[model samples]
Target: MIKIALVHHINFNHLSLSFKQRTDYIEKYLEKILDAIIVKTNISICTEDLLLLKVWNPKVYRRLINHPKVNFLFSTHNHAIPLIYPETFTEQMLLGSKVILDLINPKKIQGVGYPSEVDFPPKISFESICKVWEGIILGESRIKISGLEKDEFSPVFTINDAWSKNKIRGHLSRRAFNYRDYLHKYFRDEANSGEMLLGIQDDYKKYAQGSVLLARIDLEVILFNAPIVDGIQQEPPINKFRDLQKYLINHNVDFLKVADLDKTDYKIPEYRISDIAPCSSENIKWNNKSLKRRVENIKFDRSNKLKYGIWLSLQCSDYYCTNFQDLCFSYGDKNKKTIFITKTRIYRDQESGIKLKLLQGKTLDQIKMNDNELEKYMQYFMKSNELLTNYL
Candidate 1:
């Protein structure tokens, strides 16, 4: 049976001013996309973008939340940043998972979608985060597995070196297999019942078409990239949707939701995690050396705690502003230093509202603001502006 699970990574960051001055453009596009999916094929779209949509337009959000075809997936609350860093663990687990669950509420969400293609962390870190999700956040909600694909990571164009490319590819493949094995082993008692589903993105037209085949696993789902309209132009081309619709119809492909995977008898091809070849020791040593050099280059100040918080709040802006205060409360004084360092890595050279290089060796005290002024800034930073408007 030719089966494909169509998925999209919903990122609120994409809806910034670049998309349009008004919000209706996004809402109209969302409705149109979902409507097309409903009419053209029997497929269910799996996405984590609904939460932000809920804030933006309640009517559209209701349509999706109540829709029989949409499958909600867990993701970090803020789409701009990676969920891999140690500082983001609490935000990913507590804030990210909770918001998704609370929105889904009585309806069970089936899978977890990584925020970005570049967001892959260590396999162990991924497992640790998923465990918390399985135990705490996913109450009565059964997720088969998380999805990752080469195309998602394709945006990282800096891996020009052959050795780096080989190492990354090997690492990703091993991680995919490892995740599959972990899911099966972790839920062995329910072996006959249900297994975690890992949806890897594979486009038939792409050179990496044989990824699923290479892994010796069946293609359970194939997701088409949805266009994120930027007011100026349409992405993925509007015609691509019609083409996909025709492709699915021509192939006589059976559409499936994440929940359906659990109910059916379909099983992921069994594979041992250890059997997957590891990256060479040379690659490992090079990576360590590179990381050490990067760490040594970034200078951090330990004295001013609030300055870091203010800087982070400003950098994160509306994306994660609300969580900053609580995050501060959660961490101890000593841990703030570590948090600041992690923040530097995550944000790096990303531009912020303040127009200053946030990661460049500037401490909280260096800003020339008094304690009371800093406290006032904290209060302002804690408040989040309207992220989405109800245009519908």
Candidate 2:
């Protein structure tokens, strides 16, 4: 049985939805895509056979691509950035995963590796949008994977005839997989049969613009499949966990930690977490480096504090929240700091019974969060003395 890993970034483009609403839409939409699988292949893919993960950084995403246990790697991001490849762990697993890299616009480029030859389609449809994703699996398994053989350069394209007869930008299978066989199998079945489950990011619309939506979708795909309980759990930013809880409940899915999933049967359990989680490459490296150098870096200090809402960036526009700038720059005045808390989002910290809360509730408009808010959130960091290790 091949295990598919659908990694995606989250972005809110289609709907004027809240974090919870947006997640519901994406999870359902992606689930529909997975349900469409059997139409293209006879393979029976269970929700348990697929894993979802959310990566905050490109480094973690890149590593997931090379993970051996990941039979197939699908990313919905726009630009492909190079980062720390989790090559070691994947190689050790030796799962022979296939990699899928998605490009929003393929016709505009000359070729897969070079410039394109065709003009960009005037109007792209969701049904025919060009998403360049690669996969690393065996020949038979290749057909089971949708668009597995499709690349940026292909003679035949799959466009919605109802909408337009426009050609798809990506190429069809070029190597081990035969295009004829793939098509025969794909068209032979009118409908697909499989358990469908959608994965979405509960708090994504607030932070994403249309330009970055695709990148966010890439992370969302990963998170949707990732087992969350064993995923990286950092301190101070309890809002993340709160958001995660909301995601599970809103989707009508049960939540289980990574440890729990490992013990459960292969049959799809309500929900499961992954033992090997992905993290930001830069953040992990910064944490791994020596502490002395981190303190010397002012930017790292600010970022560390920003994570907890203690300090804000001077580079931040004035239109955003100004609290962080005021408090961090206050120099020695401790009285200038104020505790800002969220009333709605409250989660019990398993490690500490103390309730974790969001610092700000207002939707983050084009304007950024107040600097003061950052300073207020960092109180936990300052008290714990763990901020020093977060520096570069």
Candidate 3:
């Protein structure tokens, strides 16, 4: 049977509505959607919306929590950033798991909805994070389940050129394959005695439909992104819902809760980057002179190889330069007068650059040059940046 897991990520905190309006929206649209299928199908619903629901509408929260057809998974407290970025793996898991534990009892917490759809590189730290999460939820047991969104590799292909399209697909396919391989290698036991079911998102949408089918993934966690609303803004409009229902029924799809897979023993074979024959960076031509100069100018501290390498890469990459600046602003030491000093001087340089930018009227909208505003901005900036650079 073709199994499909229906999952919804309700981020109430980020919803563009007031408390009463949100509650009303949920009742009018969300409830109706559930009412239509709750009895006919099994669904897994997760939310970062519980904090608001618990405080403003306890009755609704209780009803959903107790619903027989609904299986609630724990998404992070706020689904704003990727859990892998700003914090250590252990810290992210603890914070996210704690939110779920606080809302519902530990027994009810079956799995987690990783906050973002970003494809994380295969790092040992990621594996360690998964182990820690297993300990917290399963406790002395080895079985664990993680549901990751699948839109990362193939969100859409808008390129008109056939060659470009093929190139993009090739790159994405390798990344997806490597990620799946990484999970099998790092999470499963060598003896094939443990179960670590990884569910990849496969929303019943056109963009990811092809990739999802190609992957032949074990679990398909379908997402419903549009919020239910009145006056025709509601998602999965009546016609679309009917089409989806027909598609599933025609395909002999089994609608089930994602948590139900924990009962099954599934093993994914080990695959690695080498298996895909990935293109080496050495082959790519370095045409960007500015980037080359930036990398060449940044001197690395051999004492801390990992930190130095990361810093150097961040300095060279446009996508990460701002991130590097934010990191130094938040964590870089300012006490040059201290008796004992650290070897890293790049952070101080980064701080100076930021100050220069501020003086040149290039401050971020949230920050100002004034003393009061600067202090508040720094405090807020540190917290926000830590959310992304926490692991570093």
Candidate 4:
């Protein structure tokens, strides 16, 4: 039996359900999936406990390194070394600017402000620039520009109805530093290809901030280090469809939207330069056209009742920590503060951990004497977690 160790982001506890509830739910799911595989193979199957970690907490890793069964670590947050973030830029280079062209955009240049530079089609328009700028701030990479094309290699981009020059400009840049350092060794063969890294654009490029450039360099390390695991692959190769499936299967990880996968999976570049037209201004104007729709289509033929509701912690806090803040609100009472406490536990200073001044006097143990108090607390907590699902 393959021993699998699942690593969770710190955000897991911050999810809607109580820590016990979430763990129980995941435990059952893992058993079911493995049970099927075992029945078919008729082999003894053993499962290791899933190891959850606070991705941002250095202490967690310190403990993780000591775990005996720990192997195949995965993360939703940035932790790989060499931070991977996004960068977006407006112009390829300034006059006489010292340029380090990715092989794909290999044009020898002396410095940032040189006027003798060869001119090509306006590589970026003002509208596109603005879009990418917004994308950088939002940590979302959604636009790209086409660069030199090659007949031997299949075009890396395709046109989509949702394309918008303005939206394209709003794209963000992703820098995955850990992956970059690891991937570069394998990419050395192509070191001389003179091919611009398929796509490398960042709004951060405009600022020339050392931090942003460092992020870009880290991203290159990620690209260079990516280990296309034999069968593991990112799907849709676009909107994170594949990444979500992988996380769901391996991590028992919870996510509400496909976009959330961006938070769950290891880094993947966000720019799609080959499909510049969809992100162009003219196309962005017709975002709803038959050819350019961006949002997914949903069908509602049946009644909608949520089975689970998701709760998001507006701020980060640790369990039983006095400094924690209660971010969720109680129903019918804007001023009333609430903290989600499971019915099984009783505490005097529940509010002391994650104080919600509004919930100043409320306590699950104190409220337990009230009729239906547990259900009320669970439902309210579930609503905040956004875990309730509705099926018609």
lDDT (Cα, tens digit) per residue for candidate 4, span 59-135: 43334333322221111111110011111112221100111121112222111111100011133433433332221
How does model 2 fare in lDDT? Answer: 0.22
Give candidate 2's TM-score: 0.19
Q: Model 3 TM-score?
A: 0.40
The residue-by-residue lDDT of candidate 2 on 138-233, one tens digit each, is 111112223233332211222332334322222222233222222222222211111121212211122111101111012222222211122331
Candidate 1 structure, TM-score to reference: 0.44
How would you encode candidate 3's per-residue C-alpha lDDT over 1-392 as one tens digit per residue?
A: 44444444453322122233344444554554444443223222222245435444456667666666555554433332222134433344444556565656555555533432222312333444443233111110111112122343232221112322211111111223322442333221111111112223222232233322222111111112232222222242333333444544555555554444333232322222223221223222113344334544555453543333233223211122221111110111342211111223233234334433333334355444344433432334333333323322
**Cα-based lDDT for every prediction:** 0.33, 0.22, 0.33, 0.23
**Model 1 weakest lDDT span, ten residues long:** 215-224
Supply candidate 1's per-residue lDDT for 3.
Answer: 44
What TM-score does each of the candidates earn? 0.44, 0.19, 0.40, 0.19
- Please state the error at residue 137 of candidate 4 in Å: 6.5
Ranking by lDDT: 3, 1, 4, 2
User: Which regions of candidate 1 deviate over 4 angstroms?
Assistant: 15-27, 39-52, 80-84, 105-108, 113-115, 123-127, 132-243, 258-351, 354-392
lDDT for 341 in candidate 1 is 9
- Model 4: residues with Cα > 4 Å off, grouped in runs: 1-144, 148-171, 175-381, 385-392
| Model 2 collision count | 64
